[model samples]
Target: MNPCFFYLLPSLLLIGFAFQSFGEAYETKPLACVLVEEIGGGGSSIPRTIRQTPVELHLIDPLNLIPEAPITSSPETLHLHVTDPSGKLLSPRLSSCEVTYLLPQEVPLAWVRSLTEEKRSPRALGHPWYSLSVKDDASGNTVSAVLGPQGEEDDKLTVFLAVYSTSATLYARLGDPLYVPCGFWRGQQFRSAIEWRHRALGDGKVLYAYDGRLDRIEEIFPGYEMNFSTLQSQGNASLLVDKVAVSDHGTFLCTIYLPYIRAQRDMQLEVTALPTVTFLPNPLFARPNEEITLSCEASHFHPLEISVELLRRLPGDSQFSVLPGVSLSTHTLNKDGTFSLTASLSIIASPEHHGARYFCRVRHISVPEGVTRSNTLHVAGVAGLSLEDGMYLFAVALALYGSLTFLHRKFKLVIGIHESKKDE
Candidate 1:
């Protein structure tokens, strides 16, 4: 054993040396890294450039990577991971980490649900799936990533986006139709559908519906013709309503359901009949206590109801209300649509109040709302002479009477004297 030790020592050392050499060749290496963002690098030869595809990039970065092989001394070139659609090596110049890459295609970002929490998946997917990978030659670091809806981005799809339109709420004359428009998105690869709904009100259903999805206008209504035209986009999914006719007034809603989205808008329609008012001629003249009648009649009302009032331009006042001057009086209108109201204002022989004008106003029966005014009448004033004027007039009259009597007597006496002398 002692003799074999010297001989075996060289062999053992040679085997050890060979093992260490092999280990050195396969040893793990520390990767050089420069912190960078995973964007910028499109139109790249690398089909999976991080700049082009988001899914292909590292979920988190500056993260450690196991060396594919030892970075012995220093590497002549950088090694990175990437998927080539053609399955070949790709070479390209990568941009600095600061720049951003634009989408490769135009994508529609229309979805209703997103209006709430604001889902931007639809906006991010403004293009188709692409690849991305990053390689920093200066720092021996490389990463490859995939981008865009890898499996399902529920928010990115617009296949069945819903749209709708509703008209302003308002009241319309009887036989006027309510306008409502329904719409949905036209998909890139799927067909769209639409239908109807309603709640019954009168003899017919309260709501009206028709399908307007055709090249030429088509009426799906049972006994009516509902038309469809365009009203320019108006910044929403709203479409113009076809002209309106009778039988379409009521509360109605337009609902649109797309492949994966649904939306709706509601409209209320009110219909009324033509309004009519009839009023009697105004009074010629009326004293304060005169019985003044103002007759206003409304036709087409089942039961007639009229309100009579007086308008007075008082000596001093601001606004108008019928009261002591003239006021509202009620009169029931007969089914014949004729109704009259007599209002009495006490007439004073002579009023102290000046320029007190009184006029009768008639609100027709049938319509509780119509009012008419009569011609204005003035309140007459009394002479109102003072005691001083009576005294002056009395004094003048006494003086004149005394003078006339005295003159007459004197004349008679003179005539008598003359006669007596003639007799002697």
Candidate 2:
């Protein structure tokens, strides 16, 4: 008999049992209840039956938050939802229940012993859309509900409502750019116009505009610049401006009002630049006791400043420790057109500096360029005593003394054995 047969039989048996159980649960008439979730520009529906017999579940879409750009959607969660005429329960089994949709974060748990103090009262539901049917076998009572106001339907019945994380956070880097391509169609070849406007940022600060009607602001205090990029066939829009300074940074509104659907967005803009490093590699290959200098350069920027420090990275790793007084050394400074600062690296390292590396730093400068460098200086010398000759002499002397002692012991033992045999 094949040993593999034993493993195959158990697996097949389990799969068959699961399928049989699942089919039985859904085979009966009216489903227990239906759960519907309106989230992430879509809806997920679950059909369930709640009864000793069979019950039906219904899904309602009166709000119509199912299409693109949903508003106040159902949070993703496990909600303890109750319907009108909530069913009473029996130990280990529910009198009546319904499949409900909720953001996982909004799960209202009535199972906890803390419900006596109005626990789970402010059940975290942005809206009340989950409703269902329930039956109480002990009292022969039945409950049903219709989508109504956002709160417990016909209060008096206390239960847990499902919680959810309906909204996802969108992240973006400062000064980074995103494009809204033109493929936004309204039919024919004629392009539809989109306008970009900004408010609450001290008027007249339009980062971009469609229809090519932006007036340049050269004479204004700390002037502004704007440029527009045509979108693909989708009727979208694109725009760019230099600096994106704080005086002009804030919420930007893009409105494309159509004959039917109006589209708009309040995009937040942030400006970020690369850090400038003012350090260099020690050009001179310093043999022990030789002097050399290492250095780098950097410039200052508005709205953000840079920090400079020297780092000596540890061997076999990518981590570095800031040299005790990297910026304390002598250096030169000048600003021809831009803010410039240069530091130097002095070469004469002590015997303890055998593998010591020296460098400079210019940290946290927003220059749209990130730069860094280092210098390696090896101190050449006989740093330690040689053990080869001393160890060689001591080993030879020990070997000879051991051999002589062993020969004397062996001869004495042999002679004693002969003398003893003769006496016997």
Across 2-98, the per-residue lDDT of candidate 1 in tens digits comes to 9999999999999889766544433323223232236444666645424221221111111223234433433333222222221111222222222
Estimate the TM-score for candidate 2: 0.33
State the C-alpha lDDT per candidate: 0.38, 0.41
Model 1 misplaced regions, further than 4 Å: 1-159, 166-168, 171-184, 189-225, 228-249, 257-262, 271-275, 284-288, 295-311, 315-319, 324-374, 378-424
Alpha carbon lDDT at 321, candidate 1: 55
- Compose the digit string of candidate 2's lDDT tens values, residues 19-116: 67544433332224335433353335654433232223322222332222222323432323222221111112223555343222211222111212
Candidate 2, poorest ten consecutive residues by summed lDDT: 161-170
Q: TM-score for model 1?
A: 0.34
Top candidate when judged by TM-score against the true structure:
1
Which 10 successive residues of model 1 have the least lDDT summed? 53-62
Query: If scored against the real structure, what TM-score would every candidate get?
Result: 0.34, 0.33
Superposed on all Cα atoms, the candidates' RMSDs to the truth, in angstroms, are 30.4, 27.7
